[model samples]
Target chain A: MTDISQSAAVPGTAPQRPAATLSARLARWLPRLVMAPSFLVVLIGVYLFIAWTLWISLSSSAMLPRYDFVGLEQYVRLWNTPRWHTAVINLFLFTGLFLAVTIALGLLMAILLDQNIRAEGVLRTVYLYPMALSFIVTGTAWKWVLNPELGVEKVVQSWGWDTFAFDWITRPETAIYCVVIAAVWQSTGFAMAIFLAGLRGIDSSIIKAAQIEGASLPRIYASIIVPLLRPAFLSVIVLLSYISIKSFDLVLALTNAGPGGSTEMPSTFMFAYTFQRNQMGVGAASAIMMLMTVAAIIIPYLYSELREDTHGH
Target chain B: MATLDINRVRKAYGNLEVLKEVNISVGDGEFLVLLGPSGCGKSTLLNIIAGLEDITGGEVLIGNRVVNDLPPKDRDIAMVFQSYALYPTMTVRQNIEFGMKIRGIPAEERAKATNAAAEMLQMTGLLDRKPSQLSGGQRQRVAMGRAIVRHPDLFLFDEPLSNLDAKLRVDMRTEIKRLHQRLGTTIVYVTHDQIEAMTLATKVAVMKGGVVQHFGPPQEVYDRPANTYVARFVGSPAMNIIPGWLLASDGVPTVAFDTPQGEAVVRGVPLSAETAHRFAGRDVLVGIRPEHFGLDPSGTVPVGVDVVEPTGPDTLIVFAAGGTEVVARLEPFDAQVGRQERFSVKAEKVVLFDPATETRLD
Candidate 1:
């Protein structure tokens, strides 16, 4: 690549090496050459888009890009909007309940499955099947199941008890709770699998020793097994937080910020204002807010995990 | 201390019988070592005593109470596992105090017991450190410390030193022996290492194929094994078993087998009256310990040496005898490979077994 200008300018300053030497020199860049495509893609696709959104949030953009700087005006407007306020509140409500309920249900299932049960393989596969479904599918399925007329309420009424009402999907105040239920159902199995692996990796002799030491089953798990599962718990929490922060598809498919924006989340708000509502600046600001939330939860966890990996446990 | 009685304890997993009619009982303060190779049901027998496995057709009595239906926790025992089994999340102090705490002992008492155990194990500095931070030998001490603080009636050790290095294993073995000496608690230790069994057990039960072949003091088991299997299992450089002919010479019994040199006769074996009468004209298997062979230059049992293994204390002379390889422990300076060595087998120590049944010909 440096063939023409360097040799012409230097005349005889540049020594011409043998073909073997040339190939050896080219071998030095072989690894970097092979790694370039993926590196370039990530640099453009992830960071470039991130930088573009950051700039858009700082500018006076409506449907398209504008050069005039607006400085945090879009953020102030987002804060003042009632629907955006509902979205942020719902995000916390969903994230908190989703995490708590999922971890609890997942741990219960993992402990049950760890009991050397018959048909454990089939039961594990059934429990884990929901994690294989996309959020779109889970959201759509739960929407129907929670429907007052077509699903659970109608079925319960048909079996008598005609006053049955399971319509959390339709109420403005309770709509966010329905989203939490569906999200937890879709993610609990993921947590369960990780927890189960952690449980299996423990030396079973520890349990035997505890039993011989006159510790009951519950006491053993409380004092020893569960505490040893800290790494699994941390990983599951971080992954669920990431999922909750970027959770646009599930909300869009199930509630669509529905019941007059009572169930709207930050992800849904960012999507609506960015693509459909012609307010790019507000959308970009909401997106940045969501990014900061994810980074807040994830960066320290990643730092601890990486640092532990380097230092070794 | 408690007496552990396994009365006809039979363990089976859905028709594959792991243990069959295993009957053994240890007196209070007896250190019983269950010695056997793998898959011999030695571990199953130990587990049966610990109430870890269900007894299919027998009763296990701990201090005269039938504990067949009792869970391991109610059996009033502490087990040191092969893997150390220390709760990885707990510190040394917590690990030691776990049993006492679970038993609802007062916090002060639990702390006192934990401190006592840590001091006893010389692990006072390691009380706050987790098991993962400890070395293997330290982990073993922590496991034993956990057992010690329990003050359980019986202590069960399931090959607790198998994971250590050779040098460490020896050190830990001595430490376990010393611990046993200090406490004198009734301990049932399981190991495949014959040396460990011989050195530690007041009563060693040599098991093979789910049957106790021999049960006695370590020296008695080594000197007078009940069967060919016991004879082969207990001694280091296992007892050399040679198939031979039995004949009586002036009331003292003698066994004759073919060596590379010719037919060699080992006499002066004192056989019981029944054995002498029954095996007078039958084939007898001679059991001779490797260490019992004396390096006599004018010895009658001549054999061609193949290899010399000097193990610091004694040289093991490997020789081709009859149709099988036999090893004799001789002085390091007296043994050399590729040369014939005449060694005298101690006749009184030469026990005989009936080849048809492999039972001792007493």
Candidate 2:
């Protein structure tokens, strides 16, 4: 310790120390200095805004910021509104169906493409093409495709199937299902890419050993391969949940929560109350509710994942 | 246990042929090692025998039944891979009983077989542990346990010990040999390590360039290699191939080669009468093993020692003979470099090969 302190003290009194220490200090502070702007921007933009929203959720702010506190009243009003109830129900329905169908279709495609198929690059590109577009683009494209007069119904009727009536997007009860279909189509390829990477990470000789052990292809995949893809499943679920909760642009471009406001989600509902309906306090409460739901699911997953990492697994 | 017969097997991918008309036969309960360097078609042949790869133009018989169109599961064979290939998610017991479960065997029978295999491999305490939790040697034992629980007609091992460290490889090699002796099942093992082939194999097939060069007992293959490639491949500090002339002196067949000191002749070479007669006064290649040279002050061959290396048990002296470097493993002797010495060659142990064809003359 004395030797280290001596060397450290010598550098301060040396004749050529100014030039050397200037370079050394520059080297030490350069990375932090370069990162400071973005760090400060995120500190204000994301975290400060979150704190502000939480405080506003406890206050009675309608058209502007108000400091007068009203504890839990906005939450009470948020739960009592019928449209908020519909939005909550629709959110759960969309999240559950979106998760199930995307995972199933994605894993199926990844497994099928893993069979040493021909033109696999072309097929993978085609499947992943939807993820390259913005949610607005996908929503608009799927809106036209689900439209009865312009898309599938008209195409089928042009082929002389005139008695067919395909109009799910026009009905309030079935409009959410249409939104679910469009969202699944947009993100299933992303899930497949992740699953494909996981599948490729497995040792090929395990499959060979399973084959030699008299396990059929499907049995091997179901029993051995799927269980090994737990990490991939976690990743897909977390990312898709985030997408489902923040589903604002897609709803606007596709259904606009129309046909009796049946397909309203928390994101669209939050936007309408804060900007259009002048109920900022209730809007902040709903946003906090969404944040809590996300935290509830993600905290345990992150805890386990980080605990595994620290244990050197 | 059953005999394995690979009859005229050939493997080709498009225009590139990897295995060319290979033929080998293993008796029941015999340990046959297919030994070769990388890309030498040994593993390909083993895969063909396991029905993992298709035979281009030949038949493979297990227990005298031709299984050309059978899948790997239909063939009653179990294989242990070099990577161990254990199911990472499953416990050791589950891995061992997977085959039995797929075959619809009873739970009691599966558990009994799994316990028996684990006990035999001395891994009873590891039955509930995942493969990721086991060490390399333990994982290898689990792989072997999985293979043996099936009680198949044959066992195939694809360089199973190559992934192990040297000391662990030897231990696992001994374990495999003990397993073979207790089971008495036909085994076809493929490896590139000559020592493993020498220690554990009942018969060895040394291959190169997709062709089997020599096939016999390990002792026979080592004593009388069929070609120059086999001579250089199967031994450490490989056999010396010296240019020499084959001729007879006083009705005794002899080999004469030039040394750095002088010309030397090794008499009484044990060649057949036909070989002696056919190769008289012709140039030939002489193969002498490093251990076949004995130091003698009054010996016939004079060598100028260039370098000396004393291993623990034997001293290796590198010398110039027949215009090429030669190594002779000798007993610990006080030999100085850059000094002229005389050494006697074992005449009967000397092998002669044809220079044109590179095959043994006799």
DockQ of all models, two decimals each: 0.76, 0.82
* lDDT for each candidate structure: 0.89, 0.94
* Model 1 per-residue lDDT tens digits across residues A1-313: 5888656656654455465467997899898999999999999999999999999999989999887798999999989989899888888889999999999999999999999999999999988999999999999999999999889999999999899899999999899999998999999888999999999999999888988888788988888999999999999999999999899899988998898888899999999999999999999999999999999999999999999999976
Q: What TM-score does candidate 2 reach?
A: 0.97
Give the CA lDDT, 0 to 100, for residue A87 in model 2. 98
User: Taking the tens digit of each residue's C-alpha lDDT, what string does model 2 give over B1-362?
Assistant: 99999899999999999999999998999999999999999999999988888889889999999998899999999999989999999999999999999999999999999999989999999999999999999999999999999999999999999999999999999999999999999999999999999999999999998899999999888989999999999888888999999975567889989997999899998788888988899999999999999998888899899999999799999998877899999999998999999999999999999999999988
Best by lDDT: 2
Structure candidate 1, residue pairs in collision: none
Q: What does chain B score (TM) in every candidate?
A: 0.96, 0.98
Error of 1 at A259 (Å): 1.4
How high is each candidate's interface RMSD, in Å? 0.8, 0.6
Deviation from native of the Cα of residue B48 in model 1, angstroms? 1.8
